[model samples]
Target: MTTTHEISADCKACGSCVEICPNRILQKDAAGKVFFRPDRLWMCFRCGQCMSICPSRAVMIPGLSYETDFYPQPALDERAFDAFETLAANRRAGRSFQDRPVPRELLEKLVEVIALAPPSFPPVKTELTVVADPALMHRSLGLMIDLYDNLVKKMANPVARFFIRRQAGRETFITLNNHVIPLLKERLPDLKSGKEDTLTRRAPAMILFHSDRQSENYRTDIAIAMTYAILAAPALGLAGTIIDLIPPAVEKSPALRALFQIPAGSEVVGAVILGFPKRRFLRGIRRPLKSVTWL
Candidate 1:
């Protein structure tokens, strides 16, 4: 008796398995597609090399192995591109947040979407800290503001002062020993309605993305995850703004680091304050793209 197997037509003919087969048992058919000859099956150690290298994801080894099914493909669609363009056109600093709370279930869903983001390697190694308490959110914002005030008073350069003052409201410095109050104040007006403070608008949830300091892909991995959250927020009828005020505060205060339970070797690369957007953009704008080539 003999057994025969079928090669999936969906195979992209990448030849990845052919290159890696130790026994050279896999061969390309006349159409340059990979196929396993009956004689070569005996030589197969069942190393699963063919299953691993098939880029089309059409390979299956039946009882040999199983892979966890991934959901909600993380790749962005055309609508996402349009949203990105809208963000670029407005060029408005997301200064204020709303007081609306994000439901825990929705937050979990957002995390699920983030989980789909492409990691640096096969096994993703990123961690998330979600803070939903209003008191803590305010405390974190206050800490950043206080640090910003102290740094500004210490700065002596006039140009630096002007630059800081000019962009004051738009930037959020989450690093240690940097003053972020002026920037917060400058952007506050855009976010404020009447006497109400719109910036730090008191969202129901905040998510902090952290990475191991020694991990080669720490920064890149965290960044991609954060981007996933940003894109998915709008779809969920939620809005988020990345805060840069935490890393600096964490760097300066051991107590703060302990409060957030940040490990000694890890750093907070980014933070996103999440909630429903109080203001929405209804139109798109345009700007000139600039480029220079030295050839």
Candidate 2:
């Protein structure tokens, strides 16, 4: 028996597959049709580049191992660990922010870095929306406060009482907003002291990462990309907050979705409010590491 192969009629003969294939196993027939050169299949490395780079998505590999099974043993290297520690140590929840806006060039660079993050599955479909306007930031925060109030009212009586007293005299909404606002103030003293007037006073920019729920790795891809942005922001002298409070508002408010032009079938998975860090870090703090055991 011999292996069989075929191409879809939708193939545009773009030569992308031909150019990308490491093995010369595919050739164009007289009608500009792609075909497998039977003998050349021996040279195929199973790299699947042809399928991955196909713009028409017409390439299919039969009997392909869709999962990556190889796992290298963990090897601890002090230098590498130290390098990572330095990066993590530099990441502080910035509270105070400078009035000066973050440079467009820096934002662009950070996005570029985010684009290189690894996705959990192929064909990652994540989208990012950048909101730099201070007015828009305030509007988003206001909407979040509204949503918080709505949820607070719906909470169980016991839970509601717990939170009400836990808030220490602040309104329930303010208490919820305080989670981010306090961090924002600590990183941005000027904004905290009313020297600057804005919800994200120090942050001249914000980025919202969205992904479709249908994507197999939507959550993973969105989280990875957002984390990359968060880590990269500090290197650019910027601070950011990943807002979990915004998505429900996106779901409940059509006006909010339209304001951001988020497409139908897409959902806001993550949001990062970014700006220059006004507060400086003196050193890293130690945290207790627990909940791990060797089998």
Q: What tens digits encode model 1's per-residue C-alpha lDDT throughout 48-109?
A: 55676677765454334425542233678779878876544543334455665678888899
Best by lDDT: 2
Clashes of each: 11, 12
Q: Candidate 2's error at 151, in angstroms?
A: 3.5
Candidate 2 ranges with C-alpha deviation above 4 Å? 1-83, 154-202
Per-candidate TM vs. native?
0.60, 0.59
Which one wins on TM-score?
1
User: Residue 136, candidate 1: how far off, in angstroms?
Assistant: 1.9
Local distance difference test, per candidate?
0.66, 0.68
Off by over 4 Å in 1: 1-94, 153-201, 292-295
